[model samples]
Target: MDHTPLRIAIIGGGVSGLSLAYYLQKFGSEAARQIEITLFERKSSLGGNAETVWVDLGNRRLPGKPGTPYRRWADLGVNDVNLATSPHLRTLLAEIGELERLKPLENTASYFSRDGSVALTDDRELFRGASDPSHELSLADGGRLAVLIALLHRSAIDLVESRRITPRYTVDDFFDACAAAPAEMLSAAANALNVDIDWEDPALPERLERLRHTVYYPRISAMYFTDDRGPGGMPLQAPFEYYRLQEGGSPPDRRYFEHGVQHWLEALAAHITGPLKQGPRVEILRGIEVEARLSTQGVTLTERAPGERRWEADLLIMATHAEDALPLLTFGDGLSETQRELQHILGKVRYTRSFGVCHTSATRLPPNPNLWRTRNIEIRGREDTFHPYRIDYVVNRHQNDAETPCYDRAGLPQFFVSLVDDLNRIPRSEMLDRHASPPDAPASLAGAALGAAGYRDRLPAIESALEAKAWTLFKHNVLDAECLEAQAEIERYNQRTARRRYEGHRGVCPLLFAGGWTRGAGLQEQCLKQSAHLVALLLAAPERRLNPLRLAASGGQARQRHSQASGFAPLPASL
Candidate 1:
């Protein structure tokens, strides 16, 4: 047996890249020792979006006793994990030996209208009860809820059957089909889905192609069903029996770490490099950039630093965002026709940007304190379609501030993470010092206001500099879909070329793509699932070794047939 280590180079340290390394080391077994990994991350931090910041409450204590300023951690990006939709992530946590650290977070939410009126509120999660909470709903609100639920179920059912449905149909299209549905209800549901998908032109219904139903159904259905083979599990199979389970209510088991997600990332990296029964197999490099030169034989990775070091690998993993990964690959002469086409398909994937600002601001929430919930949707005005739904997440409440309860305690203000489409909507006082870059920075609304109000004088001695800043802005690469057909094409391309590379096809580079952007939008589960699949493929071919982990093969043939029926032509393999 050939006992040579399969050199693998990873280019991103985010969930996708980090998880891939973990799985390879965990599942590779005896063959694992025969695999060597070198991961490069440009950022000094490892977990890309899973960032946690420790905030000192100094004199601004919430629910705790007033002497010393309470110190607490805040998640600035990718906060909670829903076990129902994050089964893969759950498995990862278990493998890393941190499953016991999981804590439950309340995922309840209330939707508010432009005038601070309650449009809809669901407390199934908060109460943990089976009884419906709609008994007190007015006739009109009750009617709207009924219609919205029916529409979601109908879309899920049609998508599962995949018959008589347009492959390119979008959430907007599905909403428009129900013309009799009230406009206010439709708007409410759209905002509930997340945000105005059409960030550029919210006025145009035609441009609202945020995600195709083919993509959205599986995701939305997963959220509702939470189990295997639910409404969306087997779209082709009859799901009536599974659909009936909706009555039980798929309450999200929002999970988090008492410390932060960063702890998990560190634990995962440590476990991967920990005392392997055989020997050390993973090497992680931080604060470095890597560039790859692809060829039919293998991949050559070069460090983009002063030393100009280089290393050869059996395969290359571009486990970063599509935009960041594109420039890392040297695209000149060593590439094959298929390889170029793969890059083209990747380039077709699109991304949209949004901002998450963490601040101690109650102004972003509704005026009525009684309506404040774990997640509050503040609809400024329905007519203001360009940007709808300013989502203010009660960080303390959602993360269970009972230990440090921030609300109505000592008359102290609560901390919120408001998600906004436009950065300018946020007051300069509430944005992070580093993120207040010019061109995109919001107006200086509080320069004089803070000074006039003596905000600095109120800060504790140890917290003066940072506490003066009310917000820490986290810019997110929000996943938006222009055409998911590109994803289908890429999958087909990979399957068609998988065997060719194994057989030593002259111009094939053993390259695999994994990231939230590659499949749908940026979700933690998506990254884990994609990385797991790649690990399975890597351990199963060429060398013909088996790994303990197995990923269900994506039903590519069926999707291909649907793509053809929908008239999605394969992207030509041309320069």
Candidate 2:
């Protein structure tokens, strides 16, 4: 007797969706043999943001095959995923036999968010002018740093739990409360950099406006919006977990894959898209634009490609960012309870505009070794209303296989620069150019952009460049106080729907959400946890669905697998 199998539709073929598909095949293959899953991706390939491309060095011929040229591989999106920071991914990588492939990354000890600093008298700040070189950095003692963490963690937990009885809470509210001391410390630091920031504005709004840049800069970098040296988010916050703070300074324990991040993603893809004897028959559709419509019974996905106009699914998972996901849900009515709930939650998110280009030019590579190992060369840009935004290099960020040809071919390190819109404020499409130099830099800065590196004379013209336009950086703004109220409303609605399941209520929205943005921080670490959350929801729902914290608390199957390798977390990266 064959029973009807559950049909699931996944939107966006990035890591989150792919991980979901992998887990479904892993856990559901036995119970739900006939489970059907379909994944749609707008890009020609899977692994959103995890693109592994190669550069051709003037037609370097391959061995035996003279006509064939060698192409050096580079990562466009995520570079590394630490098993310690994200243990869940370690589990997945092990399950798919990608664990041993992880190798420690080079030390990015010295970093340059701004090339040179200005001289300053105060030594208790984060910086002094780059010229001084004497007062580069000063940090609070171990006890004070500990206090900062304790205060931040306690306040956040207290505020979030308050939602059980009170109204709403947003990330913004928490930051507004916690940002004062940190902002003051940063102000002294930035002043040392010779950057003009009005830290002493009289009005509250004006003061906060100036302060937001200093506070959010690290948070944004943590999301991979710009180049970063270490985990750059607050503890127990949305962007990332708050631990790993350093009193003086700490080097990031990074590990790059021999094959690259796509190596992990493709493994998950193979589980679903490949032929497996005891696997769910998951179908992957690429290069398709999707529009999803929600209804009481189920959802309809309108795909634009291969002449497929409409398709139905019992469940829909939107793995896209908030902005891209909004227009797809068109019920045509004014609004339904469920439709409005999804809209309000998703609409609150904001994003910063930025772009990236991979090129063969050495001009963008930093002359500093600290910047060299980090693969980040911070460049100060022409002034704009937006404060603290910067452009930086990201090449060699994921390098582990020291293939000399990649360096010898061009006689320079391969470099990619991630420039924020705050540098010029021009539209990304308009800003892209064939020249390696930025269009908005001043005439004086143009030739000197390399900044005493002396490589300006040696670097080649931007022979070929690939532009990633308006890549989603980080949340432009934190969650607002009103989000708590809205989330509460969603819970109440879902509760009602669940109670009416016997009355054909379709089992409380019947939608599951998973993505880098959905939980933790917007990085590979968070994506792994978010994926596990969805898997837990699918297999062990009602008891605990989409609750990553619960997953973290319950030392279940993942924990068992983890014990076999390392204790508690993966071994600390060999510094």
Candidate 3:
């Protein structure tokens, strides 16, 4: 009933942080105005992983302005989206009403490494690690793999709902569970998804499950994780998609922003904060490091930028890696036992380094440019050998005639290559000399490696290129080993205290976690889900009452708010 505005602070300007801020400000009724939010991002620009850069791919200036320079845009960070699987993300896109921005491109049937040497498209060597005899990574099983993939997706969704929310439900857990499930369950999952079950073959479930582990998981990881390795990450494998064939949903479809994925972030920000001319009503502070002092009076954040000062808020939402957030907290007396323990658990999430290169000079593509004008290559490494190169995939951005119906022809632009390197095994310490030269120097090394592997016909015209984007990224957040342990610890602690939300020694923590890695099956969908889950928690709070009563009139708990966001229809009553 009290109408005093509630001030809140959000750390990290990533999708999780941005979406949380956006929804809190757009809480749909009178309460929306009563909330004031300030977002702080340490980065120089907004749109964390969705970064866009404008550079020349060697096109001439316009006729009118002969001397004027022209620049083409290239995505420096996360650019792919699966329209088939990410419902919650779709809801966000729908709310933004930018369906046109997400246009489909011709999906590549095969993936290869540089010069098409280690052709993952159909290479048996790709499945060198799979212990199972049947789960070979051949490209020909595409049709069967498609059906099995759908079942595996359903299994993850079903298992999460069926099993208790516990740390034991790792991706590995789901893999083995599906592989060992009762024939009836597997049969039904396949049949419901309209994938005809071979009634005579009782081993169908085991077959599908093996393929899921050997093929499906690794493929999905490629789309997100820089390199699927280390203790907590998915095993290194290729990117896979099969859910597209599931029942009546859209075909195997992946869509990217017609302009750039960055546009979505801009639009979301505009919707929440308003246009730039009027200034952001929802104040955003960039390139600022913040120190937090948390207590009942809300969060008092000290910003170190321009000048150092304190800004207080009623709540703090950490939408970044938990480790980045831990130092900011001013823990009094071991930060209190509960807070210390929380910090310890969060600190365990592991991360790895990733490197990439973007170049306008790459002249040659793989042999089948006729089949794939703009192909993406996922290099397959032998289980015994570690390829120190960061070459994850090579994408020709400018020549996507398959996916986009109508696009401008930027002269001789068919060679815009985007390359990724997740394995940071080759540290900068060893490559200082190459680094001293233009970034193109090290990038050229990638070409040589590909040619040596016997994938390319000839050397690229330009061997060197710009090291456009590189960062220390790991597999998705909470899914990793340390975070899972931490998550389990938090859940156990909550169970002992009989508290549903995060409440430490003094009242509740009032600090919620949101990100792709924080909740449910990790991905952009999880990012959206975590946002909705946090928003629902806020609404349910007696102090915050984030939104009106109708927020929970449908879903029984705050978690269901995620399902609620996957719009256009109500979830089943039982769900």
- lDDT per prediction? 0.52, 0.46, 0.47
Candidate 1 weakest ten by summed lDDT: 566-575
* By TM-score: ranked, best first: 1, 3, 2
- Choose the strongest candidate by TM-score: 1
All candidates in order of lDDT, best leading? 1, 3, 2
lDDT of 3: 0.47
354 Cα displacement, candidate 2 (Å): 1.7
Q: Residue 74 deviation, candidate 3, in Å?
A: 2.4
TM-scores for every candidate against the unseen true structure: 0.71, 0.63, 0.67
User: In model 1, what are the clashing residue pairs, if there are any?
Assistant: 58-69, 160-235, 296-508, 401-405
lDDT at 401 for candidate 1? 59
lDDT of 2 by residue, 375-417 (tens): 4424223233233333344454445324333444444334454
Summarize candidate 1's per-residue lDDT along 1-575 as a digit string, tens digits. 44677788888887888888877776666443378888887756666655555444445543555664444555655666655445577667876677877887765555555464444444544543232344212122424333334334434443535556443444444545433333432444344343242223323332122111211233333221122222222222122212322111233346767566666776777777666534338888876788988776678888888998888887788887666776888754666575578667777654434445567657777676655667665433323323321467777776665544443254444677665545456665654332211222112211211211101222245244454443333323322233245656756665555566545466665777776666544567667767766776555553334323433223222332332232201110000
Backbone collisions counted per model: 4, 12, 13
Instruction: Report the poorest 10 consecutive residues by lDDT, candidate 2.
Output: 566-575
Name the top lDDT candidate: 1
